[model samples]
Target: MTELDVKDWLVVESLQSGIPLTDRPYAVLAEGIGMDEGEFIRRTADLEARGIIRRMGLRIRHHQAGVKGNIMVVWRVPEARIEEVGQLLAKQSSISHCYERPMHPELPYNVYSMVHAPDPEAARVEVIRLAELTGIDDYKMLTTVRELKKSTPVYQRPEE
Candidate 1:
């Protein structure tokens, strides 16, 4: 991995808060961070190319966006059918994230997906739809009652 310089750290810190919601978001961000728009863009591209930044995209604030129903449905998918079932779940627009995780002895579920809707009941309906679509009914819905902390990891210069 390429080492990040001072400017790269600045760029990372500036971006941690999120890109400005504006007509010219990049320009606004670059100006705020005191860098030329082209340079800022180039540095961002370089960070991505070097694998320092794995992914960058818009993140929807589900709660603020009037999406009250958010549930994480964990499925007990057969090891052999993990891929097939995971793909089916991923195709649905309501499913934000779907992945196969290592299962614990106590918790037998392996496949997990984040489902969102307008309300909690609707979210449950979506979960049922998913269960039917994937044919994997042995599952659990983990809903968030209160979000204590939700934030991106802020990068800081390491102490020598």
Candidate 2:
């Protein structure tokens, strides 16, 4: 992979959560990094084209935005049908995340998804609908009781 420049990394860090909503956000970002607007926009586009950055956009915490509950849902899907079932679950807007995890030999579920909603009951309804749609008769729903830590920075410096 191509290494990112100091300006590119600075852009990434500055855009972690607060991306300014302006006509020329990159220009604004460039000013912050002591570069001219044109250079900032050009380099940012280059970084995106190289896949150094996935996307630059808003990061919203649904819970803080009045989504008061989140449900961790697990489905006992057959290995052969894991992908199909996961795709089905992922299609639901209510499901923000979905993945297939290794099942505990003693446990009854394997496919997992996280659904965010305004309340626990709303989340339950979504899970039930998903199960019905996927023909998954066996599943478990675990509502989050508390969040220990929610936000973390992605970039880390290499150790000396």
Candidate 3:
């Protein structure tokens, strides 16, 4: 198991809440956690290097950003070509996410991608272009009718 001191835990907690929208967000966080900015950065880098912290990224509000169309494209990639096809899908700027999932009898498509576009027509064109680029014709594009829920995960430490 990974060992983390109270200060490290405090850093994690501070990060979990949310990154401040400022010119020097990291410095602000470090100050709040009573750690020097350089030390905080070093600790974060160390955590990432050790594989404890995978990655930190932002969530784009597509709707608010004039992206009215969202499509989930599921590709029927051959087992032997899953990784290659997934990489192709991931390279597209329109495709925000690409993932491989277990193949079930009912649903044979294994590789899925989330595509964002200004409208449905553009989204379909992008999907068609993706199919041509990847040479994977077997796929389905499920359009978003409505978004029921979307939120980020919040982590909490066990009571000590």
Candidate 4:
């Protein structure tokens, strides 16, 4: 959106999904856009340098990949200790994603974390270990019940 011309915007659109899964993916992508492969790669690099693209990564379906357990652990951390405890949770190898959030009046969870394990019992054990590591007793482990859709976002320009 930031000064990207029609062709560049189209390039970004193509990139939103991913390069083709062929042997020469970039070549296929460039060919699809009627562009030279080298130029296409250069433009992508330039776009990244300009911060137009934050990350170009794959989203794996962990369950399909034989990773069974997925637990979301929320911590009711005190304001004075949230940062210290949050860092400790984030450093855990079993933990995938962790962040701090606004504590609800009734629910009162300030720190959140995502842990992945092969089984529910393993996830529970890991969550318990994380609790002992952080010394934050008040926590909950919520298991994933369903996965509706797992696709990378493709941005749509809103009508003026």
**Best-matching candidate per lDDT:** 1
Q: Score candidate 4 by TM-score against the native.
A: 0.85
lDDT for model 3 comes to: 0.87
**Model 2 lDDT-worst window of ten:** 151-160
Deviation (Å) of 70 in candidate 2: 2.0
Score residue 143 of candidate 2 by CA lDDT. Answer: 68
Across residues 15-52, which tens digit of lDDT does each residue of candidate 1 receive?
A: 78787778877777888879999988999999888888
Q: Best-fitting candidate, measured by TM-score?
A: 4
TM-score of 1: 0.79
lDDT tens digits by residue: candidate 4, 1-160: 4777666776787787676678888788888879998988888888888998887777677778977888999999989998899888778888889999888888789899999888889989988888888889998877778878776667754444
| lDDT ranking, best first | 1, 3, 4, 2
Candidate 2, residues 27-120, lDDT tens digits: the string is: 7777776888887777778878998777875667776788876889888998899999999888888888898888887877889899877798
Better structure of 1 and 2 per TM-score: 2
Q: lDDT values of the candidates?
A: 0.88, 0.79, 0.87, 0.83
RMSD of each: 3.0, 2.8, 2.8, 2.3
Structure candidate 4, residue pairs in collision: none
Better by TM-score, candidate 4 or 3: 4
Model 1: lDDT equals 0.88
lDDT of 2: 0.79
Return the clash pairs for model 3, or none: none
Off by over 4 Å in 2: 1-7, 20-24, 106-108, 157-160
Model 4 misplaced stretches (Cα beyond 4 Å): 1-6, 50-55, 157-160
